[model samples]
Target: MTLPEQGPLRLLALSPFGAPFDADEPEEVHVALANGEWHGNHLHPDSADDPVNALAIIADAVQETVTACLRQVWPVCAEHGLGMHPRDANGRLSWWCAGERLRRGPAHIRAAVGALDTLMPPRRPNRRSRRAR
Candidate 1:
């Protein structure tokens, strides 16, 4: 989908799936579906000026579209198996999830906004060989 040229938002939109860019709106950029339906406010011009704020704003807008239109959580936490929200970690924008157990800590940062793919992919262990052993 069409996003501002500035900052990591454009990269974030392309990383998960290559969201197509469109110029139909004329005045505003949109993060749209394959069918060209996008649900959220256009990226504010000022949001593109700052790296961290840009990511946060982009994440918020994306989440809004996914939740309202798609009817589900966008980037969910692997460990906690819950929806993640954009949170300011230090000066960076990160996907934050409430930790699974209270004793382990209240919450934790899963990954930086445009970096969710960096999390370890699901692995299927070699159960057949292990059982044979």
Candidate 2:
């Protein structure tokens, strides 16, 4: 299946409460890979109501997609070359890098959800800072 441009899959399962999975705003989501092939269950049917829940669900699915199909970590820490995980930064889901750039800072957010491509370019790390773009 081809990955959509919007986000993740939209299987649209009920939340066991009869609420609409998409409510009033239906959208298409892509099946992304670690490199960005996503498939299977989407973030969740009810995440539309709560952004935090949606972000968490999306991050989990993205991680699963990256790990299961690519056999490699997605949104890796370019500086440390280590796999990154998802964490809720405020209300948005951000990639959490486990590597520390210095003492007392072993973890940090790499980028917001779906923004890794912007943060990480096709070249050296020096050219991929969030402030650079």
Clashing pairs in 2: 4-30, 7-30, 8-29, 31-38, 32-36, 32-38, 33-36, 33-37
- Put down candidate 1 lDDT per residue, 1-133, tens digits, no spaces: 2222221223223221233544443345556554455577776768778978877877887787667766877778877788889999988888899887756767989998877755756445657655644
Best by lDDT: 1
* C-alpha lDDT (0 to 100) for residue 50 of candidate 1: 92
* Per-model RMSD to reference: 8.4, 9.6
- TM-score per prediction, in order, is 0.66, 0.57
Where in model 1 is the C-alpha error above 4 Å? 1-26, 101-104, 120-133
Candidate 2: where are CA atoms >4 Å away?
Answer: 1-42, 101-105, 122-133
Q: Write the per-residue lDDT of candidate 2 for residues 66-121, one digit (tens) a residue.
A: 56775666657887887888788887778788776656567778888777777643
